[model samples]
Target: MTVNIDKLTITTPAATSSTNLVALELSGAQAIERFPQYVTVLSDGSVKLTAPTKGASSKSTHRTRCEWSEPTNWTLASAADHWNRQRMTVTKVNSAQKVVISQIHVRGDDSPPVKVFWNKGNITMGFRTKYNQTTPVNSTVLKGVPLGAEFTVSIHATSKGVVTVEAKCNGVSGSSGALQLDATWGTRLFEFHGGVYNQVDYTNSTPAADGSICVISDLSLSHS
Candidate 1:
């Protein structure tokens, strides 16, 4: 049997605005067979959540959802040797703007081609688009990757005749990018997006008894 105790105190009005300040206490016998137990507080002040269980060597985790208002702008930074997937977007647009995203990957799979897109949604096959008159803007393709290596994907677009952009992760057929080029709004962008399909093999045509693994991460979005 395993047992542990954990407590949390929320100290903001916005954190408890939605829910009625419930003190969650989870106590159980074992980790693999334990369920989350809930408790409530009736005071007008802060709420304290406590959990105490029998035995030892038990692993317990806690998480809380929160919401707050910012001053229309905020800066976010990620440390080295960190991996997190994200999609960036700016609600307002301005001139001479550029969205620069950079990350230092400590250790990750680099053999497969990681596809990137200019906007939201999953990677779509058999898609193409034209940027400007200089050349027919087509789907951008990330070249081969050396296994157990580090690299970066950068895009520089301007409001000056820049049309569309697309990126596909582990793609081999057709192209990936802007689904449509006739849309308005001169918003420049860059993003890292991906999806997963369970398969026995990445390039095998025959069905197998198991499924494959796919993970897409590190997405940044902005406009210039």
Candidate 2:
């Protein structure tokens, strides 16, 4: 069949513009608007995961993974029954130099008087300990501006384990508190230790950057 382009007749309203393109194909369209989805509450008045979309899944899911220069694997193990349980294993790392994981956000307890261990990191600014017993139990407390141009809190833990944090506002004294942090070798501290010591389990400790009154709730040792 021969196609006739000149005989084609289309209906349209008169326009002033000489070049006017009508609606194109359906594929030549873009997203117009987006709206929030409505969710129904359950009988117990609890909102549950009704949809498994990207945003919803993200807000409800927890991620965990490891990263390294070499092959490594991980597995989950019960802390209480460490001796009889299977721990997370780091399997392989062929050529992938790194592994990453977004761990689950743990906010189960917020009460003071909770025990935590120095999972890792330098407890005292300049003081480093080789053994758990050598660690200092912070005692002395103060309130003032840290020694810095911008906002920075100076926490000094002496050999006696005396810990003090001074808040500095514009390089002046602000507020301080006497905090008690316990350094113990527990399951939490296990990973932070045996390496460079850059990890610690800070329980019920409030060290805010916005200059909130930092306080030590229950600073003790965390054990497996």
Candidate 3:
């Protein structure tokens, strides 16, 4: 009945490494609670996540994300179905008006199989059919979504690696249909990540006040 984040690890935009710039990470309740400005539990139990456009990012990547990653990784062959369901409201966005809201991430790969984004006023789905695909195929699944509005997104993968993604907002809905994953992904382990991921990369002159922020009011994950 409630969103549980006690076991999730939060990757904050806080600067960590001095050399190649990577953000600090916090795990569990005590650790995550220390970074309230980026991730915090609201009075109603919703989890708020923030990532500024001008924030520290991984040395290899250009953007930043105040995201919560599910610690447990599951394989496609390990279960009949694995799913992540999250309901969130985006309160702020970067100058691009785009942010990744939820995603299915591989254990070691930079490319995720599924990325559901809140782009402008449209709910877009970007998918990677191949494990190492450099770019994902993009499609608009739902529309009419506005800033500060509540929406729910769900993504699931079958044992055969068939992925399905859907979103609903203000009674409007959209789906990614059925996306078939190639065999290249069969050997990889995956997990779910949700929250605000800024689409823009920060530079020296980027304003600290500009960022992407969202609140996850409900969340759940399952494997069976």
Candidate 4:
């Protein structure tokens, strides 16, 4: 059995260099690489991730985030069931009141099959139907999710590469139905991520308090 939290790394809003962002790796010796301010594991086994809107970020991207990612990689056909399920509460939001909470990231680029967002009080998602789809199709998954209220979000995909995502807030539920993936995604390696990723780009004058924060009460990842 694998401990879900033990198999991941935290990608912070801190920059590594002029061209890259830092990844606080959690492993053997790299366990020492963690930063409490950005990624904190509470005594109750929950995790708190913070991303200041004006913090350091990659040169290529304008936003910032503090997200936990599965260290290893896998293709869509790697397992019959590949999923990321998390119980999270957004305690804070950026100036734009929008932030990405989960994603299905493709290994070599910014392109991803899924980008789940907490837009204001609505749970929205962007689905990229094909590998080369420049822009994902966006839709609202759920609405009226209040800040600081716990909610569950799940993104699942099977060996066939068909994806499904859903959200539950205050006993209300919404789903993405079934998002079909193209053959171009067959050989692409992917990973699951969840946490506070600020969607709005930060500028030098942006207030430090203009940030996003999320507390994850439970997270479960499985592939079979």
lDDT of 2 by residue, 62-166 (tens): 211111011111111223211110011112211111111101111221121111211111112212222233343332121322221122233333323233444
Residue runs of model 2 more than 4 Å from their true location after superposition: 1-149, 182-224
- Tens-digit per-residue lDDT, 187-221, candidate 4: 99999999888999877789878999998998888
Displacement of the residue 28 alpha carbon in candidate 1, Å: 28
TM-score of 1: 0.23
The number of clashing residue pairs in each candidate reads 8, 36, 0, 0
RMSD to the true structure for each prediction, in A, is: 19.1, 26.0, 1.4, 2.7
Q: 15-61 in candidate 1: lDDT tens per residue? A: 12244333222221221123212122214321122112111111221
Model 1 scores a C-alpha lDDT of 0.22
lDDT of 3 by residue, 1-224 (tens): 35678888888788875764688776848445677888778889888888888877877877888888888788899999988999999999999999998899998878988998999988898899998899999999899889989999999899999999999999988898999999999999998888988888778888878899998899988999
Task: Name every residue pair that clashes in candidate 3.
Answer: none
Between candidates 1 and 3, name the one with more favorable TM-score: 3
| TM-scores for every predicted model | 0.23, 0.19, 0.95, 0.91
Model 2 lDDT, full chain set: 0.19
Question: Between 2 and 3, whose TM-score is larger?
Answer: 3
Off by over 4 Å in 3: 17-20
